[model samples]
Target chain A: MNEEENRPVRWNLDDNGVAELIMCDRERNNLFTDSFIDAFLGALSEIEKERPICLLISGLPDVFSGGADKETLLDLCDGKIVVKDLEISERLVAAPFPIVSAMQGHAVGGGLVIGLCSDVMVLARESRYGAVFMNLGFTPGMGTTELLPMAFGPFIASEMMLGGRMFRGSELAERGVPVNAIVPKADVYRRARRIALQIADKPVDSVYLLKYTLSSEKRKRLIDARRNEDLMHRITFPMPETRRRISEQYNE
Target chain B: MTKEEVIEVIKRNIVENLDDVEADSIDATKSMKEYGANSLDMIEVVSTSMRELNIKIPRSELAELGNIDELADKFMEYINKG
Candidate 1:
């Protein structure tokens, strides 16, 4: 089966002008496995072609994402599937519209990386955020190493990924994740919709131009960093320690 | 130590290490996540508890405990099991 068949991304442009990219696959907590990436890339392409005024990327209600699927990582230990996730993450960073992540709970590892690609992040106050790769014996993937340090600065991002620390939404907001507001879990989607509507209410051309203009400088650097990270991932995947760590975690 | 004393140690550890975990009265059954314990924090909690109680726990076993009471119970179990 093709990647999209296993995990599909749905796009719904509502009458109110909120373009929603809702991710399913709650079983793995919507970790954006390889299939999830394939479907999401396709959905993003469709949205770009249609020129949606504002975009809201969300997940199944309670969980935003638990990060990269470990089972999927194990399946492609040679970093084949991980590279695919990196490609999708780059596309998300370069998306034309103002992409807002409506994060609810447990954004970790690559999940937080994808959320960072957004123009604004609206988090549920009680949700958890982490750059969790180091704990799993892997480096940050999917542009996290680059975007995080750029967004959050070197020391903070180092503490997150290298220290394998996780912070609550309110804490992350204080630390500069652009978490504008927090509300009740039920209000996450509605809050995102309200933000999108506010953006849509503006003059479309000006909004589009502003979005492109702001992201242009950082976009190329991030895309290049993603390529470097992907190459490093391929090299790191074959190390004896990497194999032992994976075996230790999964084989038990 | 009294159970309250034990709870206090747990509370202090959580507040000191895990960001946003308030030092409020906590039910043992409440999720550690609800109390702002992430996976890394949980590992620290287990490791700290091991030093206090003198025990070693497999990380897999740590995954089975969900809340403060369950974590305390698992620590006790591991101590006795050892």
Candidate 2:
């Protein structure tokens, strides 16, 4: 397919001033490829200019995102790119307005962290979520360390990040992760839209102000966590074992 | 079910979850990695196998298993608890 047709992300502002960003690179399961990242950043820029009262991000029916693309990870191992180049997490956290992530499908590694960075998150009971960076023999990145703990409790986040194990959304809900809602997969987008509409109903300036105030602490924590995570990535991403794992273990 | 049966269930699920893998080709002594089962695929296999076996083992407990045989052993441990 041509480049434009291949772009994996798109966004639009509704009449109520609720912007929806949908990622649907089904062929690749929405993994963060170069084109996907470029389209994501471009969409975010447009959405910011529109100044929607709230933004809702969603993905395909079965796979929200697969996180860092396997090719990208291999590049990092080969020194072709740096972890800092993946800037989606920072940009997502920096949006002046609130975000609602409707993760209706499996999300792994940086993918799961993207949902965690949002102001409101709706997960699917049957979809799996994980921080599988360690499974690839690298430390977690994209602000996962801080955001996961903030969303789920520190203890559960520790188990997820350290063990690199997948947890079904139902399992996470049972464990009391502090997400807004965990419903059947069919209802995830609907629930997130409801919350986004509620936010959109508020005065734009008031909603923006409240988002600014509420996310200030989180943004600051993200800055600190990013600094530490960058250091860890530098040390871990280039290891022989890490390279081996990425080469041997990365599927699709 | 016996441990051998558990291994067979795991092997079937591995074939189901991973691309280009065959049930007959899976070696109980080898890690699923040898069959090109990535982390996500492994999780799917484990989850499906657990569901089919009617047991629920914490994923964390299964993370360090070295081979299909070990995974079956772990499943057997949970199954025998009944």
Across residues A86-202, which tens digit of lDDT does each residue of candidate 2 receive? 488888888999999999988998788789789999998767899989988999988888888888989999999997878878778888888999998899999999999999999
| DockQ class, candidate 1 | acceptable
Query: Looking at model 1 chain A, which ten-residue stretch has the lowest summed lDDT?
Result: A243-252
- Record all residue pairs in model 1 with backbone atoms less than 3 Å apart, i.e. clashing: none
DockQ-derived CAPRI band for the predicted complex in model 2: incorrect
The runs of at least 3 residues in candidate 1 whose Cα sits more than 4 Å from the true structure, single-residue gaps closed, are A1-8, A79-82, A174-178, A182-184, A247-252, B1-8, B15-24, B27-56, B66-70, B76-82
The CA lDDT at B2 in model 1 is: 48
Write candidate 1's Cα lDDT for A1-252 as tens digits.
655445656788876566889887755667767767777888888888777888999986667776666666665566555457767667877777888888876677877877788887778755667787766676778778788877777888888888776766666666665456766567777887778889988876788899999888669768777788767777666666766566555443
Worst 10 residues of 2 chain A by lDDT: A77-86
Kept native contacts, as fractions per model, are 0.13, 0.07
Interface RMSD of 2: 10.6
